[model samples]
Target: MKTTAPRDQSRFAPDTASNGSVSPKNLLIAVDDSNATTRALQYVGRLLRETPNVSITLFHVLNPMPRELMEHGGSENPDMEHQLGEQLRKDQQEWMHMEETLEYPILERALERLRDTGFPTDRVTLKLGYAGDVVDTILDEVRSGGYGTLVVTRHGPPGAARLFSSSIADRLSRDLSGIALWVIE
Candidate 1:
């Protein structure tokens, strides 16, 4: 008996489906000023240093003031509503100013560190977003930004506290199943 090969062999050759097709990996690194965050960034920096077709977005989620607090500014008097409104305006102004000044250093430090570790500066960007819930905010970013992977450091409280309370890492691992997640301890 003689055997015959299929006319269409393109299915078997996966790499040849598209010639010179580059799928750039977009990495979202969720960070704060913590040792674990530093470790995560360092790891990625070293791992991705020589790899081509990779870009990084350093993301920070800032928790905005609660609505209740914003309404009254912690004052009990009803007459202080106007005062609270003024205070709120001042606080918002302060926040914008802080975003202009304070947020730059955080991104700068991370950028410098990544550069030191050999990651290209041109492939990196910084994003700052505000939300009341941290985990939700991160997940939102991952979905909206089309990030290929999420890198976060363990920020759970130490020892006994963690046993009673859930960490952001824990929630993220459970909730963010669609996206690739790399959690550094």
Candidate 2:
């Protein structure tokens, strides 16, 4: 699917070339509403203040698989499978609703903080997908969307292992070309 431009681009500084022309740059930020992610966004905002012509994208990955997926095998019974599928859909819907009602407020707060610090709201992009596959999806979007940089957060010493294992950072750094990866503390 084609990625759409974020609605709040006006909050950031306008891009201008050395020759006094427009030169826009795309920035992708992987966020999960964690403190580390917040730090990363702040760091990206600072970088954008220093460097003009950049847009920031805030991406969140939502894993859709349920615990039952691992426990339940692909049974031959169509009825059972259908019931399981329905349950999964219901669970997913509930999760999405909870996120929209609860987590969205937190995300909005973070976005407001960034805006208060001078990052344009229009530059922010939010996306959702499976957490484990976020790296591949982000990379695909980066290539297709023409983003120039990716700003990702790295957890502190104690939580670093979990973050690295779950995060898309390492894969993105290794696989994606022509995009700068910034890992914040």
Candidate 3:
């Protein structure tokens, strides 16, 4: 008997390029619902419209796993553990629902927006993932994806909090070396 892995949630755009050779220009765009994210995508749209032979991946990382979903492997009492397991299972279902309904829509809209700007469809790819630390997650993708340019938005409203908020663009910029970091305003 064979078991199959769960289907990947990513929707890779159909490559429209005629030639098989990979484009030398590759960009990884990390997106969210913030205004900053819109700015980043718009910037890419404008850039890609004029520039040819560029490939871009639209990457979105979902919020880290909720505490309720984490499994407790060891329990002194079997009855108590069984109840906990059931609750976790329900939480897992909810998480999957959020992925399908909430998360995928963001990526879909982002893709549609870029396509509307006349960017090549095949040259774009979508990645929906679980984020640990936002900065670390992005760096891992950048390294593994071979992206020459990592494009991310500087999120949050302009204020002192903007400097202190949970925005990871600054951290990413500091941590990233040898890779071009584009922090869209």
Candidate 4:
């Protein structure tokens, strides 16, 4: 089923155009297929309904393997390290395969939702990578694609009272400059 939220009714609208003639503002929405991500997407959809000349991009970052595990040798066999490395490679491949299988369906659903809510199709982008490196990847995309705003959902499980802290989002907000960041709860 489709979901939506109310548009912000503030009088002061943010300028979206880099050049004249109402160019579409690229908006990045980070998604993990989590409830928080879905809420964020709905929030963005509502915002788009209120704001003209804007586009939405959906992004999902796969959670990465733990650094500590990678750094320290946990296996007993000498060949265990090599086997683990191979296993990781296999896991990554499987993850990518899963992404490939799931990507189109997810995008199609998102696009449908956005379109139904009056957003344009030419503006959507779907990207996948390690969750730890998502901020960097997003920044790179912003620089390369000229996105003016990023809309991310505050990390919180359903029925939770507080937003959870994400290392990637924290790092991005701290390090990145010259882009508008919106965190939806």
lDDT of each: 0.67, 0.58, 0.68, 0.57
- Candidate 2 clashes between residue pairs 3 or more apart in a chain or in different chains: 8-121, 8-122, 9-122, 11-120, 12-120
Candidate achieving the largest lDDT: 3
> Candidates ranked by TM-score, best first?
3, 1, 2, 4
Better of 3 and 4 by lDDT: 3
Candidate 3 regions with alpha-carbon error over 4 angstroms: 1-24, 77-94, 157-167
Candidate 1 shows a clash count of 0
For model 3, residues 141-170, the per-residue Cα lDDT tens digits are 776666678888775556533421345777
Colliding residue pairs in candidate 4 = none
Q: Mind giving the per-residue lDDT tens digits that candidate 1 earns over 75-127?
A: 67766877878888887767655654565466567777778889887777776
Q: Write the per-residue lDDT of candidate 2 for residues 1-185, one digit (tens) a residue.
A: 12222333233332334554322376666666567766766766765755654566566554444565434455689998888778877776676566445444545555665676677666665554343466776676566555666777656345433432335566767897766777666
Residues forming the 10-long window of minimal summed lDDT in candidate 2: 1-10
Ranking by lDDT: 3, 1, 2, 4
Q: Where is the poorest 10-residue window by lDDT in model 3? A: 1-10
Each candidate structure's TM-score, on Cα atoms with residue i matched to residue i, is 0.70, 0.64, 0.73, 0.58
Q: Which of the two, 2 or 4, has more TM-score?
A: 2
